[model samples]
Target: MSIGERIKAKRKQSKLTQTELGKLVNVSSQVISNWERGYSDPNHDDVARLAVELDCSTEYLHGISGDKLSSKDVLVAGQEINLTTEELQLFNELKKHPVMFHDLASDPEKKVKELLKMYKMKKMFLEDDEELGDGFGDLED
Candidate 1:
């Protein structure tokens, strides 16, 4: 699919109208419509914002890669942080939660730490549950 198609698909998948997405990107709905219609493209900053809002990599949005979640390590604060696709999806879900909506703006580092902790805890719980076999085998009558 083309970039415009990708953007439109992602926007719809995200359940955001063009006007809402434009507001988030600080542009008018007409601009978003233009982008969806392939009449114009967003600038670099807007593209980055769109990627974040869409919970996808810029490469996916740009149609350079078919993968919505990259498998490679990401650079943050000059450090390479490796994460699996599931972990990345968890992180994205956490970042989009209402409780975390303002955390990034107030303190991104703290938010990252918190998200990492949550991800680890979640992974551990899932592992433990799997080991327990249906998570109800230990229940007593």
Candidate 2:
């Protein structure tokens, strides 16, 4: 399918009218109509924004893929991160893992921070045990 057709189908699937989609992408309804009709195409930036608003990957929008994998903008430390195609694939794959989304979704950075702290603590304990001699319990008390 062409990019325009893909966009139109996605827009319909999302239950958004052309005017609503146009507002989201900051374009006029006529522009959206033109795009849907294949009279013209959205520019690169518009395509990116459209993909975000539609909760889809740019590759899907560009007809380069049919993955329909979702992506969202991530902001960390005031920096916006746009995930690449590989990252989007990884995100989709993560859903299949045993990890519960609720556990990781709430305060993700905090979860990672706690994991790092636990790892450091374990490492410190291992080093201290090694310094205390390999098997103190095995020695005659």
Candidate 3:
């Protein structure tokens, strides 16, 4: 299926009108129409927003993969903003091979679970520098 077709299907499946989807993604209804009609494709950022708002994978929208969400594999979607070295390591390793992180996420050990949780927290804070406040924001990315 084409990206436009997939976008239309997912949008309808999400029960969103073209205008509503446009608003969520910060585009005009006409832009959404253009995408749905195959007149133009969404840019990377728009695709990211669309996938998030439509609750589907960017790969799915692009027709690269049929799976909307893969349970066994981890996907680091969209662009990475302000990723720390450790966060990049975890993300890149998972992208290369899902085993290590899967093991860590599924591990019942308290420290392993907490480590995963902390990574998520740190990633969230770093994405928005304002959340870190003062000197904490600039930690040698």
Best by lDDT: 1
Model 1, span 1-141: residue lDDT tens: 878888999999999999999999899999999999999888889989999898788878888768786444453443445666765667667756666435355545556667878778988999998888975566668
TM-score of 1: 0.54
> Across residues 22-127, which tens digit of lDDT does each residue of candidate 2 receive?
9999999999999988999999999999888887877788887666764544432333344556543444454465443346555665553454455557778999
What's the distance in Å from true for residue 57, model 3? 1.1
Ranking by TM-score: 3, 1, 2
Clashing pairs in 2: none
Q: Over all chains combined, what TM-score does candidate 3 have?
A: 0.55
Model 2: residues with Cα > 4 Å off, grouped in runs: 71-141
Task: Quote the lDDT for 56 in model 2.
Answer: 81
- Give the per-residue lDDT digits (tens) of candidate 3, residues 23-76: 999999999999999999999999999988987778889998786853223342
Clash count per candidate: 0, 0, 0
lDDT (CA) per prediction: 0.77, 0.73, 0.73
